[model samples]
Target: MAAFSRTASLLCKNAVRSESLGKLNNFCTSARGSKSYQLVVVGSGAGGAAIAARFSSKLGKGKVAIIEPSDAHYNQAMWTLVGGGIVKLEDTYRPMASIIPSTCDWIKDRATTFKPDTCTVSTQGGEEIKYEYLVVAVGLQLRYEDIKGLTEGLEMDPMLVSNYSAKYVTRTINAIDKFKGGQAVFTLPNTPIKCPGAPQKIMYLAESKWKKNGVKKSSTITYNTAMGVMLGAPKYAEVLRGVCEKRGIQVNFKTNLVEVNPEKKEAVFMKLETGETYVQPYDFMHVTPPMSTPTELKSSPLVNAGGFLTVDKYTLQHSQYPNVFGIGDCTDVPTPKTAAAVASQCGIVAENLAAVMKGGTLTRKYDGYTACPLVTSYNTCIMAEFAFEGVPMETFPIDQGKERQSMYWVKLHILPRVYNLMTKGWWSGPAPVRKIFHLGLSKQE
Candidate 1:
């Protein structure tokens, strides 16, 4: 009887080892030219990097993967300051390997196609990546080629510049410095952009610089925007409109920049309301080129009619696929596309995605909290914080709609440090601080 018991125990051990080996063999055969992970995050921007860091800490090494093509991760918010010559462009970015969590596998490749139904992502390098869960944070693409003569204008004309691209951002400061006196035109594209307030921010900064140099008396500044209002939020719009009026800056509403003549220094504008076309010659022009969702996303089945990810606005989960999620400017979240918005959405996406992985209910909800620091001058800013449908969501006890030097200090000094911490998943916006400052009276979703 003792011999029989020993043999039975040996057989049970062998059976367990055989089953494990068989499963390993099957996985190896199925994934011959592909890699697999528990979680895969696409794009290494604000949203992708933050969420990847969060899960990398939770799931441990080799369990998470981040797909990105760029070598550096840029703090794009600093580009505004860079364009204004307040911050160096080199100071805004870090090595991609340094910013990405050490535990997560970094696939240095662009995601060519997303096959949500098959639980796989094909890369430009001819490799397929399978993931148990996926996060799509691929941000917007700048379409400078969409406008005729715009691409050539950026390369050939020294007076024509844009704050939108790193390649052209430094040219903005150069153009501002070179301008003596003439019509200085700033344009806002008709498409949804990364930061809607940025075009105007640079305009204000350039105007302020000109005033300091006594160039303002001779120069005429014009803001030609396609939007019907100065800002989406009425409270902040009123303040911004007042700033423009006081500074004597002319604003043309419902106007779109259609074409540029680099040789003639001419800009063609179309009145969106009437289809009337007009030509305006400028000594200096800042073009915020039209932008759109990435081509890969536009062709994917995961997108809505507007070519944005079809995610539940509150939960940040993909509408059709429970295992898939989205964040930042790529999603159909009805809010301004700012880094602050991405920071607020990070925690919600991380929590809700974890719940989905565990086969549990998604308890966390995003409140559509987005903030845009409207830099009115070199030392003053109107910090506009709001929720969905233009509901004011102020963080400070005092009014945030007014232009304040204190807020400008925060934007220039504090926000950059906070942004670095956020990419590491250490910061999740100012919601808790807002609660404390507001003495628990702040709005909570």
Candidate 2:
């Protein structure tokens, strides 16, 4: 840690400007700077951290500052596996200090407000940070309080579990382990979740686990979702339906979980169509909480009517404020939010942002490439890769709509390496691999 600090200090003195690397009590800095940075990024999650790493490596030290509230970041995608007892929660967390590039100014504070018109961002601690360019990637916030009795039910009831947080993640496995019999329910929220496939993934794994534990005959597994269809993409939707039918996994569409009765062990659900309501007694329930844009981005002048940062969908530039841009889950990009999407978008954003900083026209546009590894069981997964319009934009030559063990292996074994390398700005999307796999069958523009 001391070596890391010394290296950062040396880099700051020689390469970075002092004003851009603002003093924070938590951060260690010994260097001085006079010039301001070219860009400032908010948040340090998958999107913010990856983009910051890319730009800092490209632009060199003293040119970028990343303002983030939390010092720790956990991968939300792997939480399902953790709940299934396939992966540990500790395997998901990475220290923000180690992941972020040393060349970048890491502000250990949250952005309380954004004044994009003035090209300034204010921290929660009342520090004002001005920038020549800005990127918003704060991601979504989980609204656990919106659902009445949901939070209390999760905390008090041992049968209630959620993969959304590490605190409740262990409860999932415990719920499964203690299941002697009865309804094992899993729900998908009414709002847009980070990984759209996560809710169902846990259900599939739970069903498989029940069979292995010899409780399949007694337990009735139900997947209740708010959406009209099983999945957003029609191709994958059909496959999922077939799998559910073959496995006897009952799905109730348009059935949204609104409340919970922990004392009675009953879960209340609302029907979207006829304004009807129903209740089902459950032995276990896994809830995926509703999500919304971060408060700072929502209230900012840079945001749109929808409360998301308004950006040109293709170019990722702020619609109301030209100096501001957004990426990842926080922006209204009309694309699914996933780590794969962040990896692909970071490259394009970095390129366009660098061009803008040099007084040049932005040249790159995001194609809305996003990927979700739908882990079915211990060794099986379906990699659903697509674009913004819900079209099948696969990175492999094979039929991606079908579930495969190879794809599962990639998600479980390979993607972490790809993510680490890519976030460090050493790699991009798997376009090269796709081309090689398809050979002459590659699509032509």
Off by over 4 Å in 1: 1-33
Model 2 lDDT at residue 215: 94
> Could you give candidate 1's per-residue lDDT for residues 1-445 as a string of tens digits?
5664354334433432453323322332233228998889999999999999999999999999999999988999989899999999999979999989999999999999987544678999998898767899999999999888999999999999998887899888988999998999999989999989999999999999999999999989999999998888898888889999999999999999999999999999999999999999999999999998899988897899989999999999888766679999999999999999999999999999888776578898888899999998999999999888878888888999998999999999999999999999988889999999988986664
Error of 2 at 276 (Å): 1.6
Q: How accurate is candidate 1 locally (lDDT)?
A: 0.88
Query: If candidate 2 were superposed on the true structure by all CA atoms, what would the RMSD be?
Result: 7.8
Clashing residue pairs found in predicted model 1: none
**Runs with alpha carbons beyond 4 Å of true place in candidate 2:** 1-36
Best by TM-score: 1
lDDT of 2 by residue, 216-326 (tens): 899888999999887777878888988899989898999888889898999989988877989989998999998989877778777778788888988888775555678
lDDT of each: 0.88, 0.80
